[model samples]
Target: MDNEEVKLLLVKYITGEATVQELEQVKQWISAHPENEQYFAQLYETWHNMLYLQPAVVNKDNAFNKLSADIEPKQPSRYARLITWGKAAAAIALLTAVTATLYTRYSKNVESVRQIAANPGAIKKIVLSDGTQVWLNAGSKLNYTADFGKTTRTVYLEGEAFFDIAPGKKTVPFIVNTKNYTIRDIGTKFNLKAYATDPFFETTVVKGEVSVEGNIDNNVHEMSRIYVKPRQVLRIYYHPKKESYSYTAPDTKNLNEIQVSEIDSAKLDRYDGWKENLLVFDGTTLSDIAKVLERRYNVTINMTDAELSSIRYSGSFKNIPSIEKVLAIIKANTAINYSVSGNTVNITRNNNND
Candidate 1:
């Protein structure tokens, strides 16, 4: 509607490549601006004789009638007749296609600049430019720009991921972040477990070391200071309204800080094992296992009996964990019966006994 947009629309209109929305915008502009009408009239008159066969060669009256019929404002206009008889039909199709292409291209150009990413599968792996490997857990996304490895290795992550960072020289660093905190990778193979709702941010480092900081006015500690050594799983609680506490700082009051614990490396591997096409589990609650199963298989898992969800599980599965095996195992451990209809799995108690 403005002058610059009007100029651009004119170019698009002439190329027969304006979208339906753009076409409406141009039409409205042309209708509103009397000066635009005058300008087009002058240009039309100048280009009128430049356009087609001379009126003297054909029957002038008939030729005029044909042109008037072709250029009817309510229907296909003179622009449509501009397609020559040699390849008129093909030209019309190509023009319409170009219209859609240009519109889509323009919209995409506007959108791709913002670094939008979506997870298409249950477990997806994204290898970054810096030789770092990211295993996007089910329904997780890692978003960054193409300008990543050159200036900085910064990315925004949603959901969970296991990052095996390539060894960084003493200078360059690898970082992963959620809404609450930042996990600075000290060239470590670590699994970060964080949900958008969970109050605690947990990281288990299997190899090398890692430092985690909470977002307390950018100072980095709320729950505890984690010096994540090999086989050590560091748990840090995040409080939205609390201040950061740094353990390494001099003259700290409480020396008995929350110590990071070293668990079985194999168990940690089982947690991060989604990278190798395996869904490994330790003595996790049946409900927790059900959530993992739902994410991996893309299904809805519901347990009506409260006791059925309380059962703990220890197993590994890949390529769709068999529902029968899992349910049978749960039934043996607890008083539960289950059935699978289509992709839905329903679990109920066999007897309502305490």
Candidate 2:
């Protein structure tokens, strides 16, 4: 979530409307990192103190003068009572804040872990423990242990991301582990994106090289291993029929092997274009194009039906500003109809009867 969403959810938790899932998210956000809990506790205490003073009565005016003239009066801290939960029937805000703290339950031995965020439609950038740079793809996740850079720098990835590794002379091999595979790099820049619904796992090298391997295959021959060269791609697809695996096409059709007089450039930009926020679609089905556009723009690109998915167009928007003009030009020339709604874009067939 963005900062506003996080703040709003915390406020909801504070006021009490957050559901179990939201409460779980809040707990995860808070406990994921030590600094989060510390910073949040300070804010929580300050807000709690302000509201704590609302219900008050004077004990004694001159009583503190017995100890010291400058001594301050002791006010009860509400949060110190972690076990006890009291009603905040005061205001909506107060009730919300209190309910956030009061109703939630947690495991006794829960070692604190705060989530590192990658919002559904947001891009996240991070510096790895090894001084490596990483741009996490949208709708993805990455998690690491607390002492990240202490002994070793390790991370877990859920969706897709690109990494620019810092040279470390193989002191500790930098590793990225996915659901079914793992990629190890001594020092290199590369991209790894395993399509959720698609069958293949793609590792494209932009600058240097990487060694990728399967996780489950015990038989050495059935195991898939590949070393991708600079500007090359290694694709691994698992076949359930043979219960085996192998390396084959780098989307060979996409390889700029033959020059075309009509096109401006005859090459795939690899991860650089995609990482730099460019979406290049060439005769791709609308279904695949929708997925690509959704990833590129972080918007829902929907089609009218399954038949519309087969629509193919060839064009390259090296960057995003060219996208609006490109789409407008396509619709102007073709029988496709399209309209933009906020971030979402809907594509339909232009009636041929007219």
Candidate 3:
């Protein structure tokens, strides 16, 4: 058979509309060449991402025209024609899903905002409309508009996420918005932790460069903007006023703090290891480690003794099923004791000060 026939068969295969004979033929073709299998994989991912496009944007004619331009010469060999038909069918199916769903669920008046959240007990990996890949840590949320990657690419983030962005687009630069700061990427890979409850926000650059911009509330201009390179971390602290004194006393709320420092390659990798369900710590305080454990295990950790909270810990855990194992490791290394009550774990110093 010619290329046109093969392309048609491939399209039918993707849409699950192919007959058993056609399916066998396509499978044989795929198995014949390694590059053929890779091509099919790439097309599959493209089709998957295309499904998320806004309804208003996708039209049959527009999609067909675009596909035609890419695979030129209207009249080609049967084999080539078949490939084109399969590709076009895949694109049409993706566009159809968006348009059909939009008519029923989404309004055309407002741009749809897509939110991908990792619940307290789960971690999620998502591919944004712009093809940027994100691995969200537990209790983290990532939101972006459906019209993303059109004129501008922007995403709002709460909690922690590791982003591997596509190459720089002059018109649509990738921007990650947190509560306190905005990270603008110039084709970079970075891990960001920006939980609202946390005292500080952290951004660790793994590759390329990212410019971070900070602004005051409702301000038209940015307060500060700084660029971060690979193997470096930028932390911004939020300090709220704790005391209210006499009328004569002035309010003394510490301004947000920003700190940038170089991190070792080994340590930087550990920082990004949360996506792999690995927890690695180096000299991390028990207080801070407790927060990490709480998020990972979806449990409450209470430190009964203040001294025990300050104890430094260093360890690595790989998909350990039980929290008791983690506490046992800590207890073995330090003078700390822990008790589990229901879903809560209480830690105290072994000296019986609490």
Candidate 4:
């Protein structure tokens, strides 16, 4: 209640003589205010250090003299307890110093870094501690701090992932960090792709809103941030020359660009089907298709023919048959011949049929 009452409670607590009611009251007092917690922690540390001190080193009369002179009546009310402890106040100071050293060493052992990696050809589903659902695509990885969803919710991404972020405490926003940019969610559902080898980073929003921010000059002034609505797609193309640009298109080639465009909500599966173990290609080029198949099936598709690589194909297949079967279906759709030997498949234009 008051400073003297709190000091007596602290003494009882340190000596393990506190009743249940007194313990709960102290806990409530400490939690009610940040400064209260800090004050109690300092006294707690000092009391803890006194436990380990040798009896011979304790000079009760000298400690009493020092404490009497050190504490002034006009100081903070909490410090008045030092005079009340009398000779014990000197031991508390010594113990407080020892506690600081121990606390520093203990803090070093606390690791907050955490990571989850998805294997190639298999999707991994994860639910964060905050009830956020994530479908990590094949050959992808996600890392976050252990303190995630506490003060803030942030995760680093490599490759692709579909996030269905739950509405968390409104004070703390959820963020997905990529190599080039960051996507901040406001109770949203979105698909993010940032494969290391791919020249572009992409985000497709299914519902709600998300902000994508990019840094071109690596400074606050040069950063670009944009918001995407539902049924819209944002693509950020990275240039080797470090040039910055933006456009609005359904698709883009290798260039220095950031594009955002509207897409049909019915066609959302075309972008998010991989999370359901289905592969969909909508007029996707053979070269790009090859990379997708390689990541999805964990196989090598070699197509050295320049003409064959440029062919566009559109198809959707569920996870019923093998990748070889999928390739066979593609080969039948196009006039392409494939020779498979073990894990490698070589594709060439069907010259004989043509």
lDDT over C-alpha atoms for residue 136 of model 4: 95
Instruction: Give candidate 4 misplaced runs (Cα > 4 Å).
Output: 1-111, 216-223, 240-255
lDDT of 1: 0.55
Candidates in order, TM-scores: namely 0.55, 0.54, 0.63, 0.63
lDDT per residue as tens, model 3, 1-354: 554465566665543346667877878877765435544543432332232333235555554444334233233332232233345454344334433432332232123667788988578998877788899999988776666776457777878999999875553568777655668875789999987667777899999989876532223223245778999998766564455311221111344566788999878757899999899989999988998898888889988777777789899998888788989988888888888877799887887432
Badly placed stretches (over 4 Å) of model 3 are 1-111, 216-223, 243-253, 352-354
Candidate 2 lDDT, 149-183, residue by residue in tens? 54334455666788888877443457665655557
User: Candidate 3: deviation at residue 62, Å?
Assistant: 40
Q: Give the Cα lDDT of each candidate.
A: 0.55, 0.54, 0.67, 0.68
**TM accuracy, model 2:** 0.54
> RMSDs, each prediction?
22.0, 19.8, 17.4, 16.2
Candidate 1, residues 1-354: lDDT per residue as tens digits? 333455567546532345667767766655654434433333222222212212124343454444343323333333334323313444344334433433333322223222333343457777788888888777665665445565345565656788888865443457665544467765778888765533345677888888764322223444322457788876555443235332212221222233467788557657677766677767877777776666666667788877777777777666545667756765676667788887888878778533
